[model samples]
Target: MGRELVIGDIHGSYKAVKQILERAAVTATDRLIFLGDYVDGWGQSPEVIDYLLQLKSQFDCVFIRGNHDDLLLRWLKTGEYTEEWFNHGGRLTMEHYERLPADKRQLHILFLESLQDYYLDDDNRLFVHAGFTSLNGVKHEFFTRMFFWDRTLWETALCLDKSIGHNDPLYPKRFTHYKEIFIGHTPVTRIGETVPVQKANIWNVDTGAAFKGPLTIMDTGTKEYWQSDPVHELYPDEKGRN
Candidate 1:
């Protein structure tokens, strides 16, 4: 059986991506579940996409859509963008992509279009860019945007009392729906930890590769993990959405 490795947000740090994958010794037989935010932050957005696309050809990979990814896709299709998006990492992402040939640019857009909002494996393990809010579970979620934008699920998990048993009526239902829930989107760095965090049944893999933290790849089975050096150190020349 192949190992399932859930990855944290890349945020365009292709260097960190490479480092962690190499350190993890990921084989073609392993399943790589990316939690998205592949772009936006570092200057290597285009490079990261290209690397992921190549990796897809070589291994079992699941790509989940992220808010920044959706934002970039919208601009790529319509050329309309909010000022907030531009200020945040869109401007830098655009600068690199502008150098892409039209055909290559379209390929990147198509890759983004093909991303999943969430994936449930045969084990009922749920992998998503962000958390879902529906009490019944992800399929019951009404807004696709919430898959990559919602923070409530993580917040609720954080607030969960460790003493609350699984059978407790007060236990979170959304968590009860799956054997394990893995997510990115919100950085664990926010809580001052530079590693993956486990709250309730949810594992937050996002170690803040977009800021000063390292990119992470964790084995879902063993919970063993590997990390690249801080993303900022990989690209000493860039501020990386800091």
Candidate 2:
């Protein structure tokens, strides 16, 4: 078996995605776990999805679904749009899809719809687009929303990392089940870091490719990582969801 790599959000920055993949020297034997948010933000959503699909054919890959990807899937299925999604980079995704041929668009939609909410590897590491609420194993009937929208789990993990409120009896026990957890919805850039941030056993790898930071990918076993150049520089003419 090859090394296991967990990647941060791509957010339509195909250039950054390409950069990280090349930098990591990903091989066909490597297991590539993408933390989601493959679309929106940048102008290359279609290209990004295409590349991911192509990458899937070449490597062992796990694709998780992010909130932005959920919105895109919903729009594809129902022709509905949420103002919030649009404001959060949905418009660019729509524009990219709209320009694609109908069959190609349908294929892309199917790919997005097939994404997993979370993935638990054999090593007990959990990969999710966003953190989950339950510390117990993620339930089959758990609300899909929590898979891509929960933040309190990260907060609790942060608290645990700082040894703050560890004595609080009410703290959730679910987080302790995994050997380590990797997530991407909440960007590390918000915390002034362009690299992966580890709070307790939870690793936040979304280094804000949607804005000004680099795209990140890490080796699950080694904790070693690689990042693209500042993503904004890769697409100099675009605003990129800012």
Candidate 3:
């Protein structure tokens, strides 16, 4: 038996990813569930993907799609680099791809294309890159983009009145759908925390590796975790997504 590790948004910090995984002493038996945002932000966006591809060959891994990933996929397929995407870390990712051969770029495209919108485990824990909007649950989510772009679900969990019992009519139906939810998008650093935050039944593991924080990986079962040194420290010259 091995641990089930849920990793937060990477945002192209390959150095951070390597550091955290080694620090965690991850093995082939330990299942790695990545919460996405693997690219953009840092200068190593392309390198991150290469490392992830390599990891899949040696370990059990689950990849989730994110908003930045969707933007990257669209850019790869159409060569349409929008201003909004460029301003938000896409520029770094795009520039990296410029040096790659066509075959390597295609491989990245396939990997990105195959990412899941959400993953549900036997334990009934939900893993999504962002949040789902469906009251019934992820399977019934109306918009595909909501799985990677919606912040309302996290906001609802963060703002919910803890005094409201689970059975109360005032309780949000979305909260009742899973045993626990794990996500990464809006970083916990936004709330002044550099660690995973649990609000209601949701665990936010994104510790702001895209900017000044570190990349984190949590053992979903034990809730024990390991974090890389602050990403900015590892890549001191890069502006990252700051």
Candidate 4:
């Protein structure tokens, strides 16, 4: 079977993504699953998307849409970029499209819309940009949170609390069982932070590259990880603190 690597949220840190891929030494035979939120927050949104598209051409890539990606896609579908989007890092994304020719912008917007919500594997692994559904079918609270959401699912699993349920059935059983879940969105001070529970299944790989930290990547089967420090500071205050 091919090796699978899960990557965390990349808020337009194209260089950081490149560096992490380099450090991981990803081969064409390997599968790289991105947890979404590929654009916004930092600059270089267009450049990052371009790189991801290029990677998709060479490697087996599964790009799941985070809330931000979903919102961006929704906006692009209407051809209406609103003020709410601009206020929450949408300005960077808008600038990315504006920098390109009109035709290219239209094409890119379509590309964003085609992304799916999540990627699942038979090996008891599920990759999402944020939390899963609650028992009532309501999305986890983090789905509405700006940017990537917290690792609350992991915490709830550790605590064995059913009240933490989301509307999404994907989360309930997995949370109860010890399945290795790879997610990005929540920033961590270290390259990889394991939930410190028995089996320690949850892995948080967002090293805050857009916020003056390193971008991270991890191999699910081997438990191996790689990271690359920020090429330059994008937002000093947001590093690992967000």
lDDT by residue for model 1 over 2-68, one digit each (tens)?
8999999999999999999999999978999999899999999999999999999999999999999
Candidate 3 similarity to native, TM-score: 0.98
lDDT of 2 by residue, 7-76 (tens): 9999999999999999999998899999999989999998999999999998999999998898898998
- For each of the candidates, give the backbone clash count: 0, 3, 0, 9
CA displacement after TM-score superposition, residue 109 of candidate 3 (Å): 0.5
User: Alpha carbon lDDT of residue 48, candidate 4?
Assistant: 82
Which residue segments of model 2 deviate by more than 4 Å? Answer: 164-171
Instruction: Quote the lDDT for 218 in model 3.
Output: 97
- Model 1 backbone overlap count: 0
Question: Across residues 31-136, which tens digit of lDDT does each residue of candidate 3 receive?
Answer: 9999999999999988999999999999999999989989999999999878988999998788889889999999999999999999998899999999988899
Q: Rate the local accuracy (lDDT) of all candidates.
A: 0.94, 0.88, 0.94, 0.66
Candidate 4 lDDT: 0.66
TM-scores for the candidates: 0.98, 0.95, 0.98, 0.76
For every candidate, C-alpha RMSD to the true structure in Å: 0.7, 1.9, 0.8, 5.7
Q: Using lDDT as the measure, what is the rank order of every candidate, best first?
A: 3, 1, 2, 4
Could you tell which candidate, 2 or 3, scores higher by TM-score? Answer: 3
